[model samples]
Target chain A: MSSTILLQSIGFGITTAAVVAIGAMGFTLQLGVTNLLNLSFGNVMTIGAFASLIAEHWHLGLAATIIAAPLAGALVTFVLARTLFALFARRQGGAFDLLMVTLATGLIIQYTIDALAHLQVFQFSFPSGSTLNIGPFVFTVLSLSLVGVAALVLAALLAVLHLTRIGKALRALSVDPKLARACGVPMRRMINLTWIISGALAGLAGLVYVTNSLTVDASAGLDFLVLVIAAAILGGAGSPVGAVVAALVVGIASEVVAAVGGSYYSQAAGLGILALVLVLRPASGVWSGPSRDEVTV
Target chain B: MPDQLLRVTGATAGYRGVPVVREVDIAVGASEIALVVGPNGAGKSTFVKAVIGELPLMSGRIEFNGKDVSGWGEERRAAGGIGYVPQTRDVFPTLSVIDNLEVGGFRLSPKECKQAIAQMFERFPALERLRHRKARQLSGGERKMLAIARALMADPKVLILDEPTAGLAPRIAHEVLEDLVVGLAKLGRGILLIEQRVTLASAVASHVTVLVDGRVSYAARGDEFRAVPDVSALFFGSGEAAERSSWSAARGPA
Candidate 1:
């Protein structure tokens, strides 16, 4: 590929990285705090997208649809966390069992969405106007806005995790819930808040993703789940900043490979990097010791 | 009785529905130290957990500062004036020393939190020197001290420690028990300590409750407990009639 083409691909990769980072941040936070490897996260993202679609169908404007999506996501995530996930966790479910539970939940959600949408691919359009060229890189207004959203989300999350009292309690709880409780950090409320925030972020990520792709289908989020999980695992499970950096690495590498090898191998490239990282740094994947119980977020 | 800071009566608690410590009663008054000592698998930790709300009592009442807190959750109990320092994973290992203290004072006002953190720094000079360091990077002694200091940040009426000196050096263990655990009691908080080392327990404890087979095999004042002849044999002996009789005989008129 030509140098100009490679640079353009890199720019496109950056935008992809932005979308992936949004989802990965939420995923890592949920995983880190709850110790639940939620395979259903992608399905929740799809649910958010469908919420936006329904809002649009009702003649709601762009901003209204955007707001509706995250609200739906948050509500659904909170309900599931407080009910199903909490029940299983209380029953002494191990990490692997919780993962299986999420997988089952994802299947249920995916099938439910598929049945509702009649398995039809819906065309999603957000006006991009004209592509803007910045030096050697090109980006649409939507793509740039998506990147802006990701930046805002990151900044907001940083402020919450570092500057706020709730954030300190969250960090402490994520590390050790028992100690956090003993120190008078109300765990149930904090966990509920985590579900809502992570769910909202997942919804926002879905909106951004579908905006970039210009298509929405029940399978849309399922396809994107691999990239989200890969980024989260690569970034050390719970760290949002780490997830963004890892997303950039995965996105750029995959886009570059797609430029040279083809789009089919792009997803494969991301997975390959994750596999390589896991092989090289096994300890990163093993955050909790064997004796430690799964902490419900 | 009204001044008793913590009291556990008929507390039969354990994992799941199986009781590990049966019908155990213990109490700590204001500025007093009550120690629970037992051999391996004797359920000393279980009894402490029952008091701290980590384990539900199968049949018991846990009262704190003259109020029945039997149904209270750990956070509620902590807010109501109980602090806990676990044997392991006690500190937020990833957090800096100062941040750990801040988390400990989560229920306090911002001003009180700041003041409490400052007090912890003064109390633990080593923590002050390494205020910016993460808890994971601290030595065993430093981590123990940090855990104790973090518990104190909440200004609790009672502090529960589960094997605070489990992995410490002998000298460091003595220093922690003397300067930190005993010191906190002197400051007027009731202390419920679970220790494996009887020697250390004897030194600072106002009272000691010995457990065998998940039952309180012996309960007496610290001085009376130390006066029991063949104390090691009493502790090491299986929970049988012969051991119980010999233990009672060794205690003389107790």
Candidate 2:
């Protein structure tokens, strides 16, 4: 029985890794390209989940609901970046200011959702299809598909980043905004593209999260953000592949602890790992992308 | 002489509207190389920043190719054919030499970009061997050459170089001035060069401007400037009397 429980925990851990990887990839990409530590990222994911929920209530098809989630996430994030975040940056705001801005924005989004949904958990009834047993592990067809979704999202993002001129410009902008501008790059346009791309992936992650847990709530995204942050931080800034690897490690460790102890211990494990990473790589602070001198220019 | 590619008149600019450099007037015409020289903290960089639109003009009119570009941003000025090589971090240090050139030629076709890269390699043969090397790995002189070659990738009609030889060996600095600046000027491109090594740059200057305390202290043609024996006096001096005793004591007024 103990051996069986360990195998089951491993299966659950793989599912958690898939979920963390999706959100962590989006989080790191946005953090790297834009250099904004958007603490409100969790709130954006909450928004994505609610958007698909609203679509479903309106009796939209599953495909349309799936598409709506990311669209809403992208739109809201783009608006937030262009308007609120932009205001702070223009006034010579530092890293700390941007972080506070994100925290406040996240709070505002979270409360707004709570007001709309009445702070109640809603059952997300996606068809589980059928269960499948592979060797010592068992998974629902839906659980297996979540891994596929994360992989596809990663593939699409990597393709866009490596294959396009806009992506090259985005990478260059991250290194030196002044030099990129001197090279005749459209600064505002590239920034907007990154916001849209990052936000879209965030939305998709939300849909995946709600489908896996079989429920959606205003606090859903905030709860999941801990794992995402741990993964993004542990992976190192600006590396998507690193995020995937970090997520797998964090996810498996957390799930294994949860199986042995409880949810509280599992969360502690993730946070402990995050603390260890920060202690070791102290230089990877909030301002990894640009220095104070470079950003002002 | 060809048409004036860039003209700055009554340019008053500074950080946050404090006016670090005041009422600076500079003009660069095609095939002409204008050298601006001054001591440290003389606002030579501020002058370049004003021309490039990095700092806003409180009150001035900037003309490029006969059109008023005072309202244009830095990126527009660059895209409109003004190549700028900043004093420091001119090349992206993390990127390879070839990658730096490719970024400069972002607006070009694949064929055109490749051709331009080949031309750069031919001009700076040292870079051809180090094309795949990161810019940070290059020596001081090689990095500067790569910076200039990258700027030339766009085929800009006018080039602005800010202290391009600030920290180079005298030999390498001489090669940069004589080979790169002179060669680019021969091809009919206007050049605005900021140099601290006043003695060396004057040899190739069509005209020279001396900036002191954020103002133009002296402006003269190269032939007239060569007549002054102690040009270093025009530089380094702080007050009016010191300024008068140096270039004026050495020779009569232009």
Candidate 3:
């Protein structure tokens, strides 16, 4: 491929990586500790984007959409964790059982958002301005800001997990939930914090996602969820830094493939990479029993 | 002093409708060590689990600090100052030695947790050198020390250790038990030690309760039991007559 082509792919890849990182971090944070493969996480993201769309239609501006979407994500996830996931966990849902619950929840959220959006296939009122050149690469200010926000969120999350006491508790909890509880870590509150944090980041990611493409429908987050899961499992479920790195790798690889192959094949390329990793690396395989005490949230 | 710090009156508890620990009555007092020794399937661990709320009580009551604690969950019991060190898996393997202790000191503020952690390191000394290491890398003896230290970070009034030395080498086992008993006693923590060896019970234990088939075969001071002839056979061997003779030997020695 041409150098310009590669640079452009790199730019697109970085932006896409930012988007994937946000979703995957949230996904992995929940997955790391709770051992839930929440397929519905994608649906939650779509709901959040819709919540922003509602805010936008109400003339609440871009700022309102940013706040509304993430809050919506957090609220939906909180309800699910409290009302649904908690019940299953009580009966020892294990990883597989929780995955089933998440899959069902995802379908419910997707259809519910689709119904609310009045079965419209596209909603493109989102603003996208002139594309700007950063060296040999090109992208809109919107995409740059989307990348910027994702980076900021990831950095903040890392700081929280490392520097803060609550973050320390969260890390310890994911490693061993029962022991975390025995230590008096206030497990219920921490789980709530995790859901809210993950949900909000996911919501922000969904909105940024719609902004870059300048169009969104019910399947917005769901289409992206496949890539998010691939990135999370690739990065190692419990580590946030690893997720960002993996997202970058997947994002760039797929964009480079799109540079050569047709656009329709780019996503499939990412999945192929994930499959290769899973097959070659048995130790990091997602099928192994998740460490439960770490992820009760 | 009161008769007991904890009392289990006619407690029955188990898993999935099958009772592992049958009707059992036991008592433990402050500044005392109660060692529960029995065979593999004799419900020793089950009784410990029931008391700490690890296993649900089928029927019966557990009283702690003169209050009915049977209805209380693990957190409530912990808040009320009951500490439990579960076998092996209790430590957070990925967490650093200090972080594991910090988890144990969960009720404390970050500053207080740090202080307690310092106290733990100061007391154990060995843990201080290994504070940054992940728990998973620790040797068997070190892990047990970490487990007990983690539980002690709660500054609990009553500490229960379940098979703390089960998988350790004999030297490591004796060393861990000695250090644990001495360190916890210095803090005045009430201890319930469960051991398989009769000699282990006689060595550092203050009180010994022989549990046979989920019932107390004999309960007395550790000193009293050590003087008796063939207490090991009474505990490990079979026969009603042998149990009676040993009980008599235990009493007549003094």
| Clashing residue pairs in candidate 2 (N, C-alpha, C atoms within 3 angstroms) | none
Candidate lDDT (C-alpha), each: 0.85, 0.83, 0.79
- Tens digits of lDDT, candidate 2, B114-155: 999999998889999998898889999999999898889889
Which candidate ranks first by lDDT, i.e. highest? 1
- lDDT (10s digit) by residue, model 3, range B1-254: 25467877778888899877666666666777777777777788889878887678999888888898999877778878889888758788877898788778878877888899999998889899999998889999889999998998988888888888889899988887887765675556678888876687467877676777666566667777777677766566542332333422343211
Clashes of each: 1, 0, 8
TM-score of 1: 0.93
Q: Can you tell me which runs of candidate 3 are displaced by over 4 Å?
A: A1-3, A90-94, A124-136, A285-297, B1-3, B236-254
Candidate 1 residue pairs in clash (backbone atoms < 3 Å): A34-A297
DockQ of each: 0.83, 0.53, 0.62
Ranking by lDDT: 1, 2, 3
**Candidate 3: residue A86 Cα off by (Å):** 3.2
Any runs in candidate 1 off by more than 4 Å, and if so which? A286-291, B238-254
lDDT: worst 10-residue window of model 3 chain A: A286-295
- Ten-residue segment with the worst summed lDDT in candidate 2 chain A? A288-297
lDDT (Cα, tens digit) per residue for candidate 3, span A1-297 = 889889999899888888888998998888776667778888888887778778988988768877998999999888998988888888877767887888888888888877877878667475556799887789887778877887888899889987777887898877767767666677788888988888887887787777666678888898888788889998887678888899999888888888989677778877987888788886783543333432364
TM-scores for every predicted model:
0.93, 0.89, 0.91
